[model samples]
Target: MFKKKVVSLALVITILLLSIIGCTSPQAQKQEENVLEQEWKEVIASAKGTEVNFYMWGGSRTINQWVKGYVAKNLKEKYDITLNMVPMDATDFVNKLLGEKQIGKKEGTIDLLWINGENFKTAMDNELLFGPFADNLPNYNRYMNTDSKQITTDFGFPTKGYEAPYSKAQFIFIYDQNKIEKAPYSFEELIAWVKSHPGKFTYPALPDFTGSAFVRHVIYEITGGYEQYYNLEDEAEIRKKIRPALEFLADLEPYLWREGETYPSTIAQLDNMFADGEVLMSMGYDPSKATSEIVKGTYPDSARTFVLESGTISNTNFLAIPFNSPNKAGALVVANFLESFEAQLSKYNPENWGALPVFSYDKLNDQEKEELADLDLGIATLSQEVLDKHSVPELPADLVPIIEDEWNKIVGK
Candidate 1:
């Protein structure tokens, strides 16, 4: 009878153990999966009918129209989300975010931000951004080549899923074929060209995006190369490395427009001067800008784009959400939609924004591929083959501000 009791007790313990195992195994996994799905659904539901304030550079009318007209319309119609386009410089927005953080403001007005490079680094370093959310976007997973270094890194800093690529840009110099028979294809030739054509060439003042890029390009050409500065963190070492480029600029000052005593305050001013025949050369961060301006009657028919023989800096711009954004779900919805085929194609249209598409060709469907192939990229635009052959990565983000500051103290003075 004791043996029977012992067997019965063993059977009861075995049944209880089995029950516990069942509860802790597949059942628990199913419960977790259900919770995730419910969370995603809740996000979608919350996003509906909410407004997302998108803060970005409002300098370009075309870009602003693309956002306010096409993007806003699409978001409203498709997702019931209102995209409020807020025109603010990235630096100003960063300052504003810093202020909010100082006050312990948990909810910020900025939902989406168009940012890249140093500004992105500043925001990320300050814990001001709201992601790891780029992977959550369906279009990003479907169309983006996340493995590509250009997409994965910004200014030599790892993106780590904090930002989604919005567009690609390459630095190119624009010159009038009518004024000069052949464009200079190297830094040495550029200096000689500027010397020969005294008071005819000058970049915009420092802090202007294109002007700053041009300086970096000069540094890349004059000071060894771009690769060395990618991992080197010593500020003094960097300042020493880029000194030749600054000295070169100082040497070239005499031949520059207005004798380099003053420079056009903005790229647009430089473009205008070039258009008005006051300057023979102007540079732009956008490869398509020259062509687009030509079409708009802002540039002469003789305007042409060219890159240096060594290569020009090319980088991808990205969109990011701030950590304290009031409408994270709405921002995600907009970001996902921006990566869609239709929106990308629209943005690629020179008439719309003239921004290059960030979509991977292999990932696109056959119809989408054909559509991209058939699009006219304008007569002034360089072929993708040519652009790719002469493209180089940008300098590290940390080094950029140092370069700018040094330029201000040395060259800009």
Candidate 2:
């Protein structure tokens, strides 16, 4: 009877060991991998016929038209995806996301956002965005300049696949060649030009994106270069470093339009002033903006765009998914399509959008290369070669707000 009991116990132990092996076996691991692949396939399949809500700034009619007419139509026909464009300011959207996070809402309406710079940093820091998923997109993998610092960094913050490059832009000053014999090519020249032609030049007020960028351009030109501030963390140190730029702006106060007592409240107002001959010059973040404005009859046909000798600031804009986005797969599809050669080419056309492409030239095929090279970027717009040659890196994301605040205190006072 004792022998029989011992044999029974040994048999039970053997069975338990076999069960443990089965649970962790190679076959079991393969099965788990298969399940994950199946789920990914389901995500793609589910994306079909789904509506993707894209939230972006709605101030530009041209951009809105491009989305509604071109982007929306293409998505529907190709992927059976509906593009529901929602116009919302980035700050407002960030606040909305924060509110949603506070209330613990897991499903959000915003599938994709047109975001970059400090706003992107804010979303990332608050854990309000989704994924290191940019690498997973086939187009991004094929066409992007993954090694380029401009593509990987957003205002000095590493993107880390949190955002996908959508477009490239540079700050350019616009002047009617008919009105001025020569445009200034440096910040010192700009001050002299403003002084010589008092009441004919002024920038939009503080906090306006373009105006803020113009201030940064001045700061970069005067504070030696942008390299020193790349790793600088102290706000006070930054203020001290940029004090000269602020002082220069204040010194130019007597020469600005309305003697700088009041300035144009928005870029549009400044642009209109330029158009109506109220101001001799206007500036924009878009290099092709002057050309588009001329075509739209807002500016004279002689209006031309130029960057300063110190090189104007340039950066890549990006698209990102919200953390609780309801249609992640669809958003991915839209983003992937946007980065494709076809979409980028369309965007590059001056009549369509005139936004610069994000694709690397070497990665493109011969036919694509030929087509892109042959495409006209408009007469008033500077060539890509010129823009690249004169490009300056944007200041760090944190430094931007600090600069804006200081401008408000000193220049805005």
Candidate 3:
């Protein structure tokens, strides 16, 4: 009886000690996690009635409408949160974050950020983001395939929960089927098509994201594959490894539109060239862009998109919180909401935004799977099955500048 009393006293003391140091029993932690106690519930409570400033590229009218209309309305009605979207270029907002970081400002205007690829790398490198928070989000924990490579990395850099994926995007070459019956299925075939049809094919110049991606695809084909460069950090080595791609580009220049003297400065210009029949093909990172353009009447009904047989590059755009956000809790709430099934579904619909959802088919409930199946991806868009089978990962963010700069040198020479 006395030994049992001593054991009980010892247990009580250990529990008291754990509580004092903010530690808890494993069972207690599990119980707390099951209910989303202080960790998430408190965040939601703190977030209510606060305004979250969302800074993003507002280039698309439809994206802006979805944000200001659907997203904002839902937040207001359900969460009692006000979402303020600030329309700005990615570069401009990144600069704003840099400025704030330099001044050591503890509270800033930006609560959430929309960025991906090199920009995400820059933000993370500068410590301008507020996370590891994505893993803590309720929707992220429930519906996200946290283990998937697509969500774990951004442009080959480990995300580590600094951001949550907003949507899936893949590179596709767009062509008018009425003009060309068959789309090229490989870089060699594409090169042959370009040579056969002189002055009918051209990509936007270097430094343009789409043009840079096109160049990267060429490098991937010429340099063997993308796996070797995963750990390759040296710029000079990358330059040497990709020299063949540079030469290949230079050699192909003579067959390009305008005899390789110049290229379109922007993707919009390339699309215009395609529309006017000056160019036979255009390309975009957005998988559904071809369909959206077709819907806009910019391309004929026969216009369509396709990936190369060897696959094309793909990436995830992400939402992040600024490090010094005035409303960190609210930002977290909003970011969580963006990753919710309803928001992802709305964003996937063609009439809405047409961006692809990030959730895996297996991760979604049967109802969610049904909803996703019911929605059409539109005629001009490539089927999701084809896209998944042929998807390639993006080059690491650090390597992009080397490739882009080298291509510029090749162009200049």
Candidate 4:
């Protein structure tokens, strides 16, 4: 009789617990949690000892060295993963992926690549990228500010978790402090200065990265503002709206270097011309580029960087996994490692890459915050406060190629 009563009481307790919780028992819930933990472990286990092929633009020596040195070393130590960084233009890689997709290739040579703006849009549109996988990164969960516009959007298009924000860049004009007492503060001031100083100023010709950025800034200041262009996708309509900015460029052309007959073909050439004293100012998308050049002894100590009072445009670059990557597991681990606090800190140092980190300052713990605060961003880099104060969003991606093509016809011709 006592055993029967004890068994009946246990059955009643089980029924009550299940009724309260609507069906899941405590043991069942625990098992589900264990399965989730196992899944994460499986991902890590699969990534170990694999080689990840990372494709990126091979334009900067400092960037190349940092990747081949610091990044490669840490990944090998932590995950036993071999990183092979392939240097190539982002467009070429995107096109490569498109070719793979068209042929229904199940595997591709690229594990990951760097891109932003239109290139990223093209990849997403063509379904050439892997996953909404950014949320899967451990470091991304802990350190990233996903709520921020800088992370969620690239050039007015939603990222939708397709890529992880890598670094931040803003446009700034570098000038010889010894030559110009004050950098131009507005389009009007810049034009006046250009007219007075003949053959002393010229941007890199269109189709160049930094050169296109300079044109975007001109559009922002002259044709109202950036927000207006986000929804305006019509090509002809955009041309009409930007006519004034073009006229402004045309009016200043004759005073440009080489009498506006030609322009520097690249931002590097423009920087070289400035260093050689052929032009008074050089401009680029990187705020710390002047600092990097000075450190290399290519630019004089007199070099300084400044942005327009109307604010310079800023954009975020990202890393994405290719759709057909044979090593998706390796790519995930590598990307997670890159977003770690250690990698971000190294990339921030001028001795390394000197690019702005994508992590929010508030997300950092006290020690991490102190480390970031201690980095000497070099003499030519602007204070974060100033850069933030004058920072503007980039124009929509679709509008960029239009600006480039039209500039070729009007300003370049």
Candidate 5:
């Protein structure tokens, strides 16, 4: 009887242990399998013998040449993809694609774009983009935060990863460092400097992003906040608060380029004048632009970039595939490469072309940053520390048009 009892108790304990093990083992296996599948999916197969037509802003010859270099080397060497740059005013491309959509031409003539702001919003609204495909890129998992998703979500849209952020740009001031003893650290100080120097400072006219950004920059400085300024929509309230900003511009009109009657036709003209010693300062989106110009003998080597003490603004530019793009997969492959750390580093290396990278550098381990840090960046570029001092500017959807019209009226043309 004692032996029987002992045997029965041992059997019960054995059955319980087996039951627990059986339950947990399958769950563990399932989790491991899911992770393995994800890892495998991330290794995108290269698109061989594919041609991608990249539609980009071709306003600058240097940028166009650089894109050609990308085609001749990077895409061909790695993915066996061919790149053709389709230069058009970004608006023209948008209109063409929209027309195609109306006529039921689902497959598009263009594959990629260097895009942001209103353009991005328009594309998203039309449901004209390729994928929530960014996740498939191996590098996507390493980003610092997913709130970068906010960019897609807030625009009354979904990203589906159809767009991959490629580079970052900000409104920055370029000054002749040899002549300007100390760069103005704040908007107030900048005003003071201009007053003292008289006719030495000016910004581009609106309707241009670079020019419109100047208004946003000033508004952000005086508003003392970002969210409220970005969300402001009430026309009356907008005009009321914006009055101070507009008045500031009107007040400074006497000291502007060509006495404010004729501002530089575009940011490019302003940059050129700054290069020629015709002006004391200029503004640019690509912080490395002035440095690049200097290298090309378009500007003097003494120019330096600075952010106001009030802080400048930053926003990411992205590459997106139009939904109608027949070569969707190829475009994704190219965009993935463009957003890769290797490509971004090369493009933004200050000396290389100096567009700030959109990828979060903080996610890069110390070793990666250090490896990238040693590249030969150009002189007069902002150091990493100085660059970090600036803030991202998010302008309201309606604001640009209002400011542009107001500027046209102010300019009386």
Candidate 6:
């Protein structure tokens, strides 16, 4: 009787141990929540009472209000940190940081910033950005590691965990569906459209993101392949190969733009022109811009998005902290919140904001996805599959200027 009781007790102990192990296993818990809690506490402890000043493009009133609301509500409630959104254009942010460096301001006024592509690359090259701290972030795993193109790379600048990607956008061709239901399906067709409808299509002036992206749009098409375009960063090779593209643009220029003498100052200007009936179409980095703008009373209700048959470049923008930031922990909290599923969903709702969510769809639940489906989504719903099928040209920093200068010379603007 004693031996039977001892054996029974041992069996129960073994079962309990197995149950505990199984419960904590990767397949069982569905998340590594333990690590997150530990890291969150550590981050909070390190950044207890600091305020982070976030600088970003503040052109849109709706986006500014959205930022204000998110910062005021969540950061205070959860982290007891204050976030101040410093509205500065991208160029100004870079210029300020460069000036600080020149004057030896080790700790500058700028704490956190939103940047990507050329701006992010310039900051990284100049060593104006802060830590290799992204991997240490508590919610880092919620994102695909820095290896994912959207997370790891910026304008061919490898992030090296320096920046956290917040959202995705793409340079898409825009047109009126009512006047022209059959959008141009090829670059050749686009050229044909310009010839068919002279003075109807135009991109913003040089140095503008939309216009620069339009230059890249042409580069990706004439290069014959996406991989080749990404790989050919050599200055001489780029100039030589891109000549055909420049020629194409130069030829298309006379027919475009009013008198082909002056161009709209910015994509926003181009959008305004389109709204005023000066142009039939405008360019946008955000494929959903038509819907988002129309909802906000910026663009006409009839506007829509389209893609050339060869496709356009899709890129992700990111948030980063300066090395001299006074509120490192607060910045982390803000960046993490921006990447959270809740924030992303709110951003993707066309009626709400319509910014593209960078989070992979596989990571989201059925309920979350259903919300996306139920959204009064924009008319220009480019399926993720179709978007993934498109090309994303990662040009070398040097070549950006070459294309822009040529664009200027072509338009004489």
Q: Go through the candidates in order and give each one's C-alpha lDDT.
A: 0.85, 0.85, 0.85, 0.84, 0.69, 0.72
Worst 10-residue lDDT window, candidate 1: 27-36
lDDT of 6 by residue, 1-413 (tens): 99999999999987875553323334212212222344677767645565778899999887887788865577777777777889998878998888776655555577689998788877887888877767766456674444566577787668888898777887777777777768887888888888888888888777997888887777777666545655765667766777787777776777887746677879888888888878888878777777767777876667778777666877788889875565566677788878877787777766556677777665557886676567666666665546645646456555688878766655444
Candidate 5 per-residue lDDT over residues 200-252, each given as its tens digit: 77777777678888877776666655566555668767666766666667778
TM-score leader: 3
Off by over 4 Å in 6: 1-38, 48-50, 89-110, 192-208, 229-234, 251-279, 292-301, 350-352, 380-391, 408-413
Clashing pairs in 3: none
lDDT of 3 by residue, 1-413 (tens): 99999999999987765554434345323332342234788777778888889999999999999999999999999899999999998889988889877855555678899988788888888998877778788888887778766788998988989889899998999999999989999888999999999999999998899999999999899999888888898878989999899889999988999988999999999999998889999999988988888888998788889899999998888998877676777888898999998999899888888887776666777887778778899898876557767888888878888888888888745
TM-score of each: 0.76, 0.78, 0.81, 0.79, 0.76, 0.75
Model 4 lDDT per residue over 324-348, tens place: 6777777888888888889988998
Q: List candidate 2 stretches off by more than 4 Å.
A: 1-51, 58-61, 92-96, 99-109, 186-200, 253-265, 276-279, 360-366, 408-413
Q: Any runs in candidate 3 off by more than 4 Å, and if so which?
A: 1-39, 91-104, 195-199, 258-261
Decreasing TM-score order of the candidates: 3, 4, 2, 5, 1, 6
Instruction: Report the lDDT tens digits of candidate 1 across residue range 230-319.
Output: 779788988999999999898889999989999899999999999999999999888898888998899998899999999898999999
Deviation in Å, model 5, residue 98 alpha carbon: 2.1
Worst 10 residues of 3 by lDDT: 27-36
Taking all chains together, the TM-score of candidate 5 against the true structure is 0.76
Clashing pairs in 5: 108-324, 131-160, 131-162, 132-160, 132-161, 185-309
The TM-score that candidate 3 achieves is 0.81
Give the RMSD in angstroms, all C-alphas superposed, for model 4.
13.1
Q: What lDDT score is found at residue 324 in candidate 2?
A: 69
Better lDDT candidate (1, 4) = 1
lDDT of 2 by residue, 232-285 (tens): 987789899999999889988889999999999999999999999999999998
